[model samples]
Target: MEASEIFENEDFLWRLVRHLPENSDRNRFSLVCQRFRRALLPFRTKFLFNCERYETGDKVIYLQFDPEKPEVEVTPIEWTGLLPMLQACAQTFPTIVSLSIMGLWSGSSSLPTNGLSSVLLHPRFAHLSSLKISFFKAGVDDNFVRLISTACCNLTYLNLRHCCPRLSDQALHSLAGGCTRLQFLKLRGHDRGPNTISDFGIERLLSSCTRLTDLRLCVGFNQVTGWGVRAGHALTCVVMENLNHLESNALSQGLQGKRLKRLSLHGAARLGEIERLVVERCAAEVVEELNLSGRMELKDGGLERIARECRRLRVLELRGVHGVTEEGWKALARHAEALEDLDVRDCYFFREDCLRALRENCQNLRHLLISSYFFLQQRSLETFCNARPSVTVKVYHREKDYVVDERVGLSGRPLGSRLGRRPTLYKDPVRCYKVRRFGYPWFEFLPFELVSLGIV
Candidate 1:
């Protein structure tokens, strides 16, 4: 049956919406649904009502969306049957775990906060495992934070990105004290002026709430040095930036001997901070995925250490670290036995030999991103690709710097001349040669040949 025919059933529709990704534009989906049903879905799981500036690529995306008149107006008088719907949902689905509401903008005017706040702060949402609120620029301060913490005792994931107003150390302390089960806490994209988040706040939050496995703080720190804070032993993923030597060392010391799976310090450019040293110390054996994309100070020795220590690494990103030579690149055969995804895009010292070795040893390696050094010749590219039937390799091109369309390598050889026709390296034929002859992006260019002939 056709997809359009299958979606006619309401059962399928509700199931689809429930499984639809959280980041999907529900507002747009609701507008489309207006054609099918006169009103929105009223799913009770997710509802978005806002009048912010909307953009889809180069054009505005909302049909009945006027900047002055957003469709769903949330006022005390004009509840638009929403309050009744919520009451119905609460009666039906006793323990709905996820809820989110994005409120007013800086310039855009708002509705009555009391009604929405009352519904959100109710006992119905006490068992909520996840709560994500953003852009509530009205007045979601200490009281709101305090209320959420007190009510949602078992909340594992709480993300208040870009929604802090009058949120102070008091609110953070209250949250840490109250919600002991919070595992994923992200409080980034906050307003800089009113928000007072420093080492003290972070330390207070982490020390008390010891169950966190994924913690991300994109705010600036003050007062307390790095050693003062203690991220719990259960933490598996951490994305930290601009951490000094002391803080990095302290964090490493705390997380030592733990089963840390993902460690991302992609933006730290400090050479003298001993941050690389911290990496060497912390993720010795257990870490499965690591991202040190732009740390140029990491030398061949450090790369060797990672290869030696992290034997079970599944994913490794060394995008801009150019210090590693063929020795370090080839050393992956000895260690990193289970390496599946390897990104060495801007590592200028990378060669084709590394690919040959990785193919022979690491049979499970599925994804690879190599530098431009190997893209000079089609034979070289094909040789590496042909060896690994299960791998997807994409050669990096400087999209901005290099003017020519990077369909094919700029070898300057005439497209016809190589296969014997004419002597001209112009646009159409060269691009065809690139897309067909030399595989671009997906090395297996055509599907028929890709499977039947085994990854051509």
Candidate 2:
């Protein structure tokens, strides 16, 4: 090879090496051949690193590191191993655009929040566009917010899950003020203290993250209620200066019109003024996948209003909407032709025909989960499969294997004259168990592959 070409090739290897995490793959590469090893010599200072796998590429990049790894003494040894690597990756790839730190609670039950100081604050992460920090116990405290603000300055997509003691309005303030570039944000399992997340935090978030195209915020738990109760304050905690915070009444005041393609709100039972606040205000038709499973009460016309407003709805979940009946579900399903996923578990007061109506009408349905004790019956199993040929049915019958589809058929004549005179329930000769005593019932285990009806 030409000397110039070799030099260019070496430079390229160095660039790729800088992006690799400190993991087994890099270790294997380092030992492959002397020339390869020498090419990787620049990164020899890295004692440990971690690998992050992306589903699309099928390639696992090892992010490498070095220097004195911080002593987060209280942090579990296994999880602590990645902290130094993360810090090093941030330093080396200052422009590293997409990064995610997930399952931080690995190797331990408790979340380690100490070693997170300079890791995110480093200028290297300033240009990071996509960031996801999962399983870390974070609070809305100044230090934590500072880390997020300083590090994810250019973030466009962010997912914060199960983090912190309480993520308050202050944290939302920092994110909205700083990460104005955000387009998609998900805040799941982020507690703002017990029954306390005022609209201040959500309003700031909605206001600041204006460019947000997808937003999922699960605010309250099962036990809170009312307009000012639990996460209820989140919706009313409106700020008009921010167009996104324009309340229903202030709709014409700000950016006046907007829409969301996907929305999921849980713990609706905590909302105090459910009838007026939730039903009247949230009348947007942009949702494609809507799950209202966490709310216990759906007032008289709540579900009907949703069916009327969310006309573009596709995937609807009314798992805990007990107030909804077969008629109400049918009303909602009428406009939901594009619907693909429907969960109707424990809405028992409704008739079984409601599901039949769905099977006949919602032909595009794919996944249907029904409770064992609800309106689900053995007869409807075949109807379901026949209606949506692409659908997979999961019945919850524990004691009986209700096989409605025919398995084996009676073909050839009986073997003997007297004993086999009459045709009996087709039994598998291989599965027929022998009896040691007289009058012991002849039993056989049916093959799961049997195609004909066994017993329903």
Candidate 3:
């Protein structure tokens, strides 16, 4: 068969396009011909629209290729044009299952809520399973939530971030009544708003959304004292930030019997006796990732309890926690055999003996981030680098100055001199070969360099 004939076949094109992993690649492939575009249309399921305002007050809208990565194609549009764009998207991508719209600015112009509602409530989006609306200045309220609940009956994932100031407990009540099949929900409030959704709304939502597995509430939900979360029986992942003592205790008490896999309690600075209660009651076993960053009341006893209990822990973040001593770290190294990623940044009490203990015991450890507030001897760092060359050690000194030491070769030599600069113990211990490759030609470029670098 001729090459042109093979390329013209729609079935062949559809098979190839379906296997293309990334949306960017599929989009590029569709540009080949009309036949390729038609073949790729069935698999196009996601639509992303972002409108952001820079410091200079210029508003730009664009489509984001990947949500996890920062790659965008800017298409500037007026505030009034948002409705038409959404309407066009609904008409063009009738089979889209996931939709994300971000208006990340506090502009003087009000949002066209009527137009937005018309497009969202359109029959073309009846099967939409995921919807994310973020950072709108105004117009999102209980009525809008009710409209979404009434329209998107199949929605399983909903994320609202800094978008709803007028949203209150009544919105939650509406969602609970209409969106009973929701599995994941994230509500991040604006910093300036009053606490609109309280425990009553949370309790109602959890009780109604029986299949909810992952729930995250970040700033602005100050009224949520953790009592509302106790109703979630199927929750496996939970992230709550900037919680007070009462909230932490309530959350710990609520999560007593649930088997969570990932839990992060960021900025729970006042978790004193509640820290132990959290470990014993909820996160004793089965939890894989735990982040207790900025919990000032965490002590050696709490550390010991976590090490002994959470044997399945793979990722541990203890940033800004200074109460743990060498004894607690030793206990952690002895017990946490499955530990792979550990971040002890801003921990001033971390010592050389703890590093040695971790280097000797943690076989699966691959990433270690420590602060340079208390310097570890160069000899100890070199020893650690040589022994566990697979592990990438990052010593964070300040916001801008940090060292990343990655494994160089089978010899396990630290890539310090690769940067053509001397390695200093406190200032710069080692530089990554990935960063060095851009400016230097002496270092041989390896295809696997990025994977080995482990840049977070």
Candidate 4:
């Protein structure tokens, strides 16, 4: 066969595009020719529409893989032009499974009275399985959510952020009644909203979405006491952050007996009895990742209980927790054999004994993050480094506002080795380097980026 004939074969091109790993590579491949672009259309599943208002006009830059051409367009349109843009996208990508729309609100200008109804009520988006809407200054309310539930009945994942305070339990009820296939849901309300979604709404949604496995309620939802989460029998991961009215008993009741694999309770200040209840009931053996950061009531007793019960725990974050002492470290070192990543930054009580315990017992540990407040002697840090040459040790010096890697000495070489010369110091005292571990300095707890990347 001729070379052109082989290249023009649609079946071969489709097979080739399927093997491309990254979206960038596939996009570049599609740009090769119109035939390649046509072959790539069926595989295009994700679309991102980001609208930004400039002094010139309102610019809409959307990532759409049009079979006619692979080039993206930057069009200037009015605020009302959003509906037309979405309509064009739906017609172009009929097989789209995931969609993201950001920056919908155009400054102080009010949205149309119908809200997103004109954009989301289209029949072409019936196949969409995942939807994300964020950064709306206004207009998104219970009516908008109800439209989503009605339009996207097959949606398995939904994320809503910074919506209006008027979005009450009625929206959740609508979602429960319409989208029963939901498996992942994230709701982050505006910072200055009345408590719109209380335990009642949460219970209704959990009971209706029987397949839900991951749920995150962040920043708002102050009225939620976490008691309604018990209805989700299939839940494997739960993140509840900044919920001020979260009661210990309700949270404990919700968590008990569920086979959770990951749990994060950030800013839950009143975890008095819930600490023991969590370790004993929910996280005994199945939980692998746990973040209890900023829990002032968590003491050595809670730590010891965690070490004893959660034997399979791999990632543990205890940042800003000061109540733990040397005794807690000893218990963790003795039992947490599967521990690989540990963050204890800002723990003023962390000392030399704690370092010794970790260095001697945590054989599987690969990443250790700590704050410089405890100020362990340089000799002790060097000893720990020499003992665990494979481990990545990061110390955040709050005073200098820099990070130092204990694994590398001042000479930028492995700590145990000397290059036969005095170490040279740089002119700048502040040195910063990115930690490559899964969950590290950038994210004090679980890395939410994994969710966006579809890895978790």
Candidate 5:
């Protein structure tokens, strides 16, 4: 067989180096065939090797450099270590569109001063549309922002979360100027300067980016509310109106029906009287994604109004909020049957009754994130699951204290296992959050000597 013929054969290529322990083994295999060589290209784009498994079976790799021993074992993708691979990937996968730098494996303490510049300045990124960067503390200097704006002219989607002290109104202005064709812009929990994105700044961006469909504005700021609740501030009322005016202008200019689909105002606690703002300018029918996190000032009626108006809402995130009761959830369930994702985390007074109501009405519910303090009404949960077999619940453990069930006389699981039982995958949020490094025990709180309740 010709060497090129072997490399081109897709069927046998994966099997060739499938059992090879080392990633380097594939390089040697590639020389054997052209198909193998082509196969190696994809692997280079995404590396699956674990650092721990370098010597043994199924090793979990660590991307980040850790000095102090961590509480639990972690498999984080270190961005710096994978720079060479990323460059190769960029070269090989020039047409690659979406890029998400997420998880512990894909983050850096500081923005890659030179590395990022290359990517943004490269002609490759100019054609790209979507980019997501999170958990990085980088000074988004003027030069860096300019570089991005100059390169990412065609970008339509952008998400920058926890990338603080770098982004400012100047940066946003640059992006607005360059990415005139932007469709989605998410600035989550990022600290921009005072008046960085004021009414004028917002008007500038919104008017320019007529194609924007989704916008998320979350800014963390200290404020002494008249009511004494210290919550973060979001886009000002003036800015929101400016946005509305900009949208209206865009519609007048050329865009039809205002293509704006989703608008998120996360962690804007200081923005009092959200209801009036929503009622006054925001076209509830067009807005699909509404995120109100840690905004204690918002009342139940405000939420009710939103449900009544925003009939197209599909994703609603209400995290760390108050004043929303069971009735509010019920109201949303009744109105927004299209709601697929509902996050009610850290709402102190949020009751189990709301969950039951959600199960009964929101048939389209797919993703529900609740706080640890929130408990699933066992009967309601079972009934809901029975009714909607596809629903997956992701509950974050907040409460450790438990009381014995009055009827069953025991807590958690029932007295004994059923005839045919299955192993449940229960994760410990406490331990998971505490884990600093790898080699940590999976079940830290469980008694090692406890006998199994299974019918073994």
Candidate 6:
């Protein structure tokens, strides 16, 4: 075959694309949620060959030219410096769908709303749907609020979690007036803040943005009492964190009889209330995802009840709730035919055997996140993955620096085995955060193993 013909092959083109350099932008994953990853698509083309990179500076000393004791104050990076560099991306990728601007230093008050404000104001981003600006320091004042109101009208998903103290109830009101089509909204504010959002903001928002399906609001600071929890009909997914006593009841009353598909009582302590009010009220078959992360009060029967009711659950996140053992597993095994993603990261009581049902029944089971306390053996891993080849295991080992054994996985299966039962492809260990680096086990007979495995 000719060299041109070889290069022009579709497989060869994909091979070329796979080897390209990865993008250094850390905030990319913040926008893409697990809902997007539910398809289990390979992310090979999201890298950048042209995005600008940043570096730290080096200095010898502060200028003590004329004094015995001299001091200098280092200032935070100005947004003006970073804005021009990002313009290329904005200009090139004009119709950017999702934009998330997060993280401003604690003491620094000069919030850089300019960069995002410029992007939102651009005419090219008319179709932008998702905008998340979280953890930024104060000064989400009227200017930024007005900018979002006028510019981002077509937005469906907006997350302003713990963003700024200056983001008052009025800002939420403005957002409601403008973004009339928002389906997913997260307006979680900090506890210690000058700006407080009462039932006024939420009531206005619910009244205006009538198309809300998913909502996550922190009722920790603002006490939204009587009129706040009245509007709840089309809400399919609800995640309320840091809720107090009275607010929880109000939430229950509002959410009664709603056919919710996903419910997360995050940081909410009342397990009985959750089971009685939320679980009992919602349409059981429709509840696909349940996240009771950090709720220690969950009894085995509560989870069992969840299993019995929401049998079609696809995603289960029991991060710190440790009250289920065999009942939960058995329920998942029998009914969760659509189970795909499972996260039991901090559940110390759960073992590797807890996933036996999910392994057996759920044919499309792809991602499993478990604690290192769960004893996962080589044969067990091999047997599980051997049954279903598309499985990926992520073990959160508590050790600071963990290195796996070279021959820990089941590599050399028999030649006459199933076609899909190939070698175990281990995903990189996630540490600190989502800094994913590939894990390569050291093989003694590397070439021989490759040859035996028919890769060479």
Top-lDDT candidate index: 4
lDDT of 6 by residue, 313-424 (tens): 8888878776656566566566667778888777765655666666767786777776544244446655665566666665554432122222224344431134434243
Summarize candidate 1's per-residue lDDT along 1-456 as a digit string, tens digits: 333333344443343242444454756555434432322344222222211112111111122221121122121112344555444444444455776544435513232245555665666666777777655555466777787888788899888766654566887788888888989987654324355555567667888888888876544323224443455666787766434332555555555555678776665545443334435546666778888777767776777677677777899888887767778788765577888999887886776676667777887788877655533354555565556656766654542111122222223332213343221122343223222222332222321221111111
Descending-TM-score candidate ranking: 3, 4, 1, 6, 2, 5
The lDDT of each candidate is 0.55, 0.48, 0.66, 0.67, 0.50, 0.56
**Alpha-carbon RMSD to native, per candidate:** 9.9, 12.9, 8.4, 9.7, 11.5, 14.0
Per-residue error (Å), model 5, residue 71: 36
- In model 4, which regions exceed 4 Å deviation? 1-28, 31-84, 104-116, 377-382, 397-406, 411-456
If both were scored by TM-score, which would come out higher, candidate 3 or candidate 5?
Answer: 3
Residue 272 lDDT (model 4): 77
Runs in model 5 with CA error above 4 Å? Answer: 1-111, 119-126, 188-197, 220-260, 352-356, 371-377, 387-390, 399-456
Q: Which structure is stronger by lDDT: 3 or 4?
A: 4
- Tens-digit per-residue lDDT, 1-456, candidate 5: 444443456454453222333444545445433422443444433334443233342323321111111011122355544554445435543444555555352356444456667755655445666767666555345466567668777777777665534445676678778888877776644443332444344456766776665555555322111111001012211111112112222212222223335444454435556654454445566666777666677777888888888877888878888778778777877778788988887776666677777878887888776654524444554455556655655444332211111111112432122433322223333322222123421122221222332211
Ranking 2 against 3 by lDDT, winner: 3
TM value for model 4: 0.73
**Candidate 2 regions off by >4 Å?**
1-77, 91-94, 104-113, 137-140, 189-197, 219-258, 268-284, 299-301, 394-456
For model 1 the local lDDT of residue 439 reads: 31
Candidate 4 local lDDT, 1-456, one digit each (tens): 333443455444453232333444545555543543343233222211222122223344434333432222223234445555556555655455666666544632344226356756677667678887666666367877888888899999998766545668998999999999999998887667774788889889999999999999888777888888889899999999878888888888888788899898988558675467567658578989998888888888778888878889999999998778878877888889999999998887888888899999999999988875424655667688778877777666442222333343333332212343222222222233223332332312221111111001
> At residue 183, what lDDT does model 5 achieve?
72
Report the C-alpha displacement of residue 221, candidate 5, in angstroms: 7.4
| Residue 276 lDDT in candidate 3 | 62
